[model samples]
Target: MHGPASSGWLLVALCAMTGTYCLTRMRGGGATEQRRAAGGEALMGFGMAAMAVPAAVFTPPSWAWSVYAALFTAAALPALWAARAGAHHLHHLVGAAAMVYMSVVMAGSPARAHGGGGSGVPLLTGALLLYFAGYVLLTGVRLVPVAAVAGRNGGGGSAGWGDRPELTRACRLSMGIAMVAMLLTL
Candidate 1:
């Protein structure tokens, strides 16, 4: 069996994938989808990477931390506005909060040889993990049938993203898993 030490790489890879997904979502026109894909997602990717790969953000200039904090906090605001529309907005809000928490952890901690140490708040981490895990399980169940349908149709269906059930569910599941991976590194 693989050891726990090796698992960090998987989390790192997931972070990269989440970043890529965010960028791709920028190109997609779905209102809800695009809303979740806000610019803060790239920062979310960076925040997660910093957690998994110690060197990634261990020693940036002081101002970078401030920017990250501001950006992530700002990102969460819209999610509040979007929350009335659906649970996905709530996910975004949580994701943004995670990013902000991460930024604070990174900014305050001094760089060290092994990853930099910070005051990791367990309560927050646990909450994030729980939420994301549920999201992944739900997403996985949704994807099973979508694969069969897509195969039969030769690809994604012709319906608009809002009209396509699979697309939104897939995105939710993807980000949820990504968030879980990120939280694990903390």
Candidate 2:
């Protein structure tokens, strides 16, 4: 209940729904890449929920910072390793790192000290926001109508989940926006 409760719930619902979609995607029997994508979706789903609480309540447990920071940090490593595979992997790496950064920031405060102000905003926070904003926009544009985002891993046509590129891009875009919302609340 820090910002508008409705907005908070909206984010929560969005994240949860997307996460469930990811879960379904996870079960999606395709290539290794499809499974990886599904895993990221699940993370975003739960991650959004984690962020949603603080967005609404304006307060998160002190321990949550360490937990999220560590979780995202751990998530980042695999993403980095996968980066050699393609540009999408690079994006995933960056996204994971962004989550880590946000977690660390929230952990340090844990009481909404950074709320709606510029006095104490970290320099890195700005950079992170810039990256995510660009990511959201880029993902959005790439998903225009019939145009598919590249490096889907599921290959083209009849690939089931991977066959539909928009869903994949939407997941990334949604998480990026969610991350921005979480950062602003911090």
Best by lDDT: 2
* TM per prediction: 0.67, 0.81
> What's the TM for model 1?
0.67
Give candidate 1 misplaced runs (Cα > 4 Å): 1-12, 29-52, 56-58, 110-118, 148-171
Local accuracy of candidate 2 as per-residue lDDT tens digits, 26-88:
776668887886797688678767667635355666787788878878877888888898887
Question: What lDDT would each prediction earn against the true structure?
Answer: 0.62, 0.70
Clash pairs for candidate 2: 1-56, 1-57, 2-56
Q: lDDT tens digits, residues 34-107, model 1? A: 64554456456655655565344334576776787788888889877878888767877888887777667656
Candidate 2, lDDT over the whole model: 0.70
